[model samples]
Target chain A: MVDVVGSASSLHYAITGRPNCSLSAAGTCCVFLSIATITLIVAFGFFLAGAWVVLPFAGAELGALFWSLRYVCLHAGDYERLTIDHDKVLVEHHTTKQDVRFELNGYWARVILDCQPNGYCRRLALRSHGKEIEFGRFLSSEERLNVGRLLKSRLGGYLS
Target chain B: MATTIPIQDVHNEHHADNHPDHHPTGWMRWVMSTNHKDIGTLYLWFSFGMFLFAGALAMLIRAELFQPGLQFFQPNVFNQLTTMHGLIMIFGAIMPAFVGFANWQIPLMIGAPDMAFPRLNNWSFWLLPMAGLLLIGAFFVPGGAMAGGWTMYPPLFIQGGPSYDMTIFAIHIMGISSIMGSINIITTILNMRAPGMTLMKMPMFVWTWLITAFLLISAMPVLASAVTMLLMDRHFGTSFFNAAGGGDPVMYQHIFWFFGHPEVYIMILPAFGILSTIIPTFSRKPLFGYRSMVYATVVLASLAFIVWAHHMFTVGMPIASQLFFMYATMLIAVPTGVKVFNWTATMWKGSISFETPMLFAIAVVCLFTIGGFSGLVLAIVPVDIQLQDTYYVVAHFHYVLFSGAAMSIMGGIYYWLPKWTGHMYDERLGKIHFWLTAIAFNVTFFPMHFLGLAGMPRRIPDYALQFANFNMIVSLGAFVLGASQLLFLYTVIKCIRSGAVAGNRPWEGAETLEWTLPSPPPYHSFETAPVIK
Candidate 1:
């Protein structure tokens, strides 16, 4: 397997060429629960100290915070992957809820990076025989360009 | 297109992260949304509603003061109205409206897909209504809301009834919400800029917000501490502000002014940002003194800390401390003068357009300067001793807050309404609203300057006969001003419901990344981070 991983120093999204994710494997639900627990416990302590009015507002605030964290956790495992072999190139998209895969014949696949007039990268789309698929929507512009160049070299042999 | 292979397959099992397909529709969408745009809309509408609510209280105040001598409300009730009016306008209306602007514009301007903490953004906004509920709820409680003024100074505040506790709780809740919002703003600005978009390259609105966020983070906590001490004195038998129990009430003023002075900047800095944004766009030129504008904003924010004592100049400090504060407060005019000059220079010799937003921007520059000059006059210790708590102080702040902050908010709404709703507001109606607001506002406030100079104390239900004519004119003007805003409401609703569609780049001179997107931006904006050059 040819593996490529995003460095920790960059934007927090970590991408690995292998099937396994480098993201923290800690359960997302557990993270929110701990945060809520801590917040409520501290707030309850204030309530015990005679600031009784703080309890309900604290609950309301932490409840909102918990809901927000849950959304982040639900989307934490999201990523897109591309695989190339002698005969086919496959694209897989994985979310916390589901996985999707697309298969294309290696000989007819094309990679394109449509850039603005200012030479800034816009989007990365792959086209083949009347079908098109776009990915790398989450990556930065420079990263999208890098990914486009990598895909092009990997799929070079089948050009007419 | 380079052809290297052939492909034919489709899958919907796992959609992309920011795809609009999964956005929750209807009421739950608002309650649980982590999206910045949705939350921004909520903040803006809520604040506008609060503005009207608070403004109604102000109209009643003017009505009571119309003929002087207890016309509408008893003294205590009048106290409640004035206190609630100040609190609601400062915390409820102006602050959140700016936060709303921050929410809608920051991510789009910076090329970030969403705020650094999307969920935190949602939480911060929702807390506002909860806090507002607590405050509004205080009116129904016994003793009918805390009447110790919005400043909540002690001894009197400690003596208030049950509503005082509720107000304290409300303040605490709002302060926490502000801190969360400031954290989100600071984090997003520091960490989420697109490649090549350095701090200096960031939009002026973003820079102003960056500094404002720091102000909120630092100053809000002082307020929290001050209020907490007040709460303790009220409930826990602590003597933080009770002189009879061995505490000094003046210490509370020191702490409160420390927060209060910076809070003034917190309200105006964003207006400065809004004006900076609109002026250059309409002038059709790059802002003059971009680096100096940034430096000037920092200088003003820094000076804000040292000048807290100027507000309490009549509170009897040592002459040395008094002189230090007076000079420091006066020194702020230097940076402020730099900003005003820079804005004028930007407009000079440039292709300037007089759109609705531009008109409001120009009005803010003129009226806010009048307020600032009055502020300089008040900064001198002797003059402040005379004008302090007089209608002149009232007039000065109304010019600053109403004509300055509120007017800029109107400008921002006009400038960005096309981008937000994808429709052009009726310009004729906009101009009419502007004229009505301007005329009525001056008639309402300009007389107050004379009333103050003639020695009329504020926050009182009764005054001598000499101030009656101006009071009547101000009341008449207040009624007209209040009614004129109906035009603003009608204009906004008309534009949102049915108006000409706005194409991308509604304004010809607009230059931000937000202008590069669709007129009504998609639910997921900037899904792929933009590279700013």
Candidate 2:
């Protein structure tokens, strides 16, 4: 079997890709999306309100009723799932899936942690051959350690 | 070949091996605590204090409104009471309670040792009490506390009493505290996770908090700037919002709502997290649509920024602007609906029980829906035109804040009291508190809907004779509701002092890692991390 711990390091690199998608790029995308989406939603609320007011009393009530119905429709079902194997971590939801895998042999990998003193958990990062992958992006330190050990034990021999 | 690895040694290597004894003692401990749990406790106690303070103000307002025609205080003082009461409760009471929960639980649930920036946590928390002092101190100032509503819209705000500066300064400080707190939360959540804990496997509470933090960081600064401009207009003769200074007052509303709307979600999303955690545990089921809940929170946060203008529908923006805000505002219900349905589905066919926490969770679901329905009503331009600034609007938000947000917080406290105190709460007392709060809350706020429909405006000291009876009833309920909170405090204190000792997992149904540890968890938990199956 492939060494799981070593694979985790390689997997980290594959997940984050290269210098192409920098942290700044992701931050910019997040900012752009936030401003664009908020502006659109506020504009739409005004439109419906105006239409309701211009209409007669019954029309206004109908508008209110319709708004409620639409509200329910737009807000109601959406979630994602993640799983880990020896060579890769899999994130899947609905119709989408991303598999990140790594090769442990002849590659050096290091674990990086983000520690918080006030009640937040520390995060783990695996870096190998100039590429970095973060696991436990959603877990606390204890959970990360548990997962980390399993991978470490499995892949220790393959990684330098 | 045999190899022995000390579990503690391995655990220490994996986590931050900070020695708790090295921390300062006595009053300095509180001032310098970087421990999330310690900070969390500080936040909780502070919020409780603020709640009582605001409640006192509310009682005073109710006493004045008890018989109408102004009995207890003058109109100006009443306005101050109303305004300060709203500001204190929203900023000081409810929001801090949620943050308190976040600080305490996020690290434990995620299995991390602490928050990312512990020192910053201390700074964020200390700012609250100081801000509170300044705000309450405003009453002692020469002119008395501000009388404009909590929104603190300008023009009226600029011309307010001397205490206006104190209130504004306090607000600025509070806003700063919130932004820093949000930043800490986001960085910790984003950067910290143990091995194998993928984002999708994270708890709903963590996911919701992550989104709420994002909302706080992005929107709170805008509010700070808006208020800063208001301050400048008042003191420095700048006119960002003053019409005579070539600035439009409407511009202030736009900027304020942009921040204000998301701020509402920031207050409530954690409640959503609390409800999500409680409902699943009580139902004896894992949260249904776990990933969906995360998505829903993100979608809701995204939508919150857009729908803010709906608050200004009556302010006469162009038709296109109204349509956009209304539609966008309406769209938010979609993601929110997903969360509600997921909770209900989590309960469907599961071994559900009506423990006090679950009861509160259930009440939150039902009552908050009523609030949401009213929110939809407000989203419609014509309906809002009729209801805007009326008691109808009053009823709408009280449902959301009091019943929705506050109720969930209470439930969370009750659910975790045993865990925090190492003792089970008096169940009978808990039930009484729940029933009293539920009944009193409904009695207080439900009629405001009818009062609103009758066209009684809010924030007024006196009303016409026609609106007298409902107001009287509402005032009575308000007294009862205010009185009921004492029971909660008593219950918490009693449990902490001398309730029956609870073993690990006081609630047999609890599934989280927190329940796995002994009640009143050790100074250090999971010295040897427990493996998740």
TM-scores of chain A across the candidates, in order, are 0.63, 0.34
Instruction: List, residue by residue over B132-159, the lDDT tens digit for candidate 1.
Output: 9888888899899879889998889989
**DockQ score of the complex predicted as candidate 2:** 0.03
Candidate 1 C-alpha lDDT tens digits along A1-160: 1235443232222243321111132543554454456445645554564444445655655565455445454665567776665556666666777776667765677886766565556666667765667766566567667777766765543211
Off by over 4 Å in 2: A1-160, B1-25, B526-533
Measured with C-alpha atoms, the lDDT of residue B374 in candidate 2 is: 93
- Backbone N/Cα/C clashes per model: 5, 53
Highest lDDT scorer: 1
Q: How far is candidate 2 from the true structure (C-alpha RMSD, Å)?
A: 11.9
